[model samples]
Target: MIDFGFTLSKSSTVDLNKIDHSRYDQLVKLVPTARMCMNCGSCGATCTVSEYKGMSVRKVLYGIQRGEDVKAMLSSCMLCGKCTMVCPRGINTRNLILNLCKLYD
Candidate 1:
């Protein structure tokens, strides 16, 4: 059977110089309010799917910012709007998720 989970070499760290910024830039344009995120954890606290492992808005956003693989986390989002309702910054969390989905497409 294929292992699919082989460990990387110690030197295989992420090359920050090779990271792509196009997708992130497009997302910023589509959802300007995303830049206002305070990493306050309100969105994650209110997420309906937060109880599930590996599904937090804050973590997903951070992954996106770093150009990491966040597709799984984004896919798990229920888009219930609860995060938006409780966001202290009044960010449109639902729309942000929708826009992020479009970006991955």
Candidate 2:
């Protein structure tokens, strides 16, 4: 039997606590939507793509605002508009992702 774990012991030469919140710090605050979401899992649950890669149309946008690389989400959307219809907020999720696509480019 062999234990294999890559571990770094404490040392003055290594500064493990590197601060890196620049992504979130540089993002513009998302304007609060007038249409309140009921927190229904309908969008996440019924999402056709979720079965493949597990995406929430709502959470992806939130993650983008906080400056996450949400590219993994792009592939999952079928653009079939199921999420838009189910959204109580009437937010155009597909359009949001379409616009978000430009950022990655």
Candidate 3:
């Protein structure tokens, strides 16, 4: 019999002032439609991956805006274009995810 009592807890504090704004600025410049996101949750609701996993396009974008590490979430995107089709704000969700992936790469 093996008893496992080990648990890993992840915790970190983000300093907004310390985050490099230039990277985000460059990203926005590359994907101008990203700035139009209204955070309306439409993208998240329409996401196929989000239904299986907790990944949401809106959340990932917000994390990027806050300079948070969202590589894992960003990688989960399928680029199926469902989110973009449902976007009321007309944000290019697929392209945004691709750009984020490139940024992290």
TM agreement with the true structure for every prediction: 0.80, 0.60, 0.79
* Collision pairs in model 1: none
- Per residue, candidate 1 scores C-alpha lDDT tens digits across 1-105 of 777898557664667897787887888899898888889998888778878856777777767777788888888998889888898898888888899999876
* Candidate 1 Cα outliers beyond 4 Å, as residue runs: 1-15
- Give the per-residue Cα lDDT of candidate 2 at 64: 48
- Model 2 misplaced stretches (Cα beyond 4 Å): 1-39
lDDT of 2 by residue, 1-96 (tens): 465676667553423255334332332222233124455666787788888888877667555444556678776777888887888787666766
**How much is 47 displaced in model 1, in angstroms?**
1.1
Best of the candidates, lDDT? 1
Model 3 agreement with the true structure over 1-105: per-residue lDDT tens digits: 565887656764667786766656877998898888879998888788886666777888778777778888787888889998999988888888888788874
Clashes of each: 0, 0, 0
**Ordering by lDDT:** 1, 3, 2
Candidate 2 vs candidate 3: the TM-score winner is 3
lDDT of every predicted structure (CA atoms):
0.82, 0.61, 0.81
Ten contiguous residues with the weakest lDDT in model 1: 7-16
Report the error of model 3 at residue 59, Å. Answer: 0.9
